[model samples]
Target: MELRNRSAFHEYFFETTYVAGIVLVGTEVKSLRAGKVSFNDAYCQFHKGELYVKNLHISDYAFGTTQRHEPTQERKLLLKKKELRKLEAKIKEKGYTIVPLKIFFNDRNLAKIEIGLGKGKKLYDKRETIKKRDVERDLKRYVK
Candidate 1:
């Protein structure tokens, strides 16, 4: 199953994307397999030179024991040191942010997050995007 943060595109202009593995526990993995995830208000940030995703909610598994995983806990992202350093350097610049775009399992059945280096869009940019999307829809309808 794949879960996407649809709002990320509307809110940011992505420059580059990276696929990074996530550190998840047993219950969290089960929750992901069940497609119980929310990306609302989720973002990536560096803590002590390591990257972590915050506010990416993975609900507790229904059949879990008393000690269940927290729904909105911060989870570490696994990336190469070179990539991490590059991202950290870019983040130090102005207006650059790390946004989680989607979550999906790889061929090996490991959960991975696709993150993008993006700049937040302005209000006018968002309006233009909407107008363009509406025009595309109209064009497609006309073609059909």
Candidate 2:
């Protein structure tokens, strides 16, 4: 499957899990199917025991008028209660965050979002990651 924008892996280290079932407006779903969505700067937050995604941009459907949904409004994420509890606990103890990794359609034609449990990386850690990536790239070129 093709991936859209990926957050800087150097900036956030993730432990990921797959989650299913998110409610979206008709326009949003249509925009997504047309590949007019952006995950950049999007993040997940827990509110009143439910998870919500904020700052995700789903562009307006061309056929839609002013009634079209806002591009960056908060969207609810569907997850089990037990899983929510587990995520809450881990976030509290480990200072981790939830982020949307990817959005895709499953075989059933349902929209699914892949979320990740992650920790923010420090400045030095980011530099280290960049250095490692450069080295890997160099190695690949040399091998070729």
Per-candidate Cα RMSD to the true structure, in Å, reads: 0.9, 1.8
How does candidate 2 fare on TM-score?
Answer: 0.89
User: What are the lDDT figures for the candidates, one per model?
Assistant: 0.96, 0.83
Name the 10 consecutive residues with the lowest summed lDDT in model 1. Answer: 25-34
Name the best candidate (by TM-score).
1
How many collisions per candidate? 0, 0
> Which candidate leads the pack in lDDT?
1
Show pairs that collide, candidate 1. Answer: none
Q: Write the per-residue lDDT of candidate 1 for residues 24-126, one digit (tens) a residue.
A: 9769998998999999999999999999999999998999997689899999999999999999999999999999999999999999999999999999999
Per-candidate TM-score against the hidden true structure:
0.97, 0.89
What are the runs in model 1 whose C-alpha is more than 4 Å off?
none
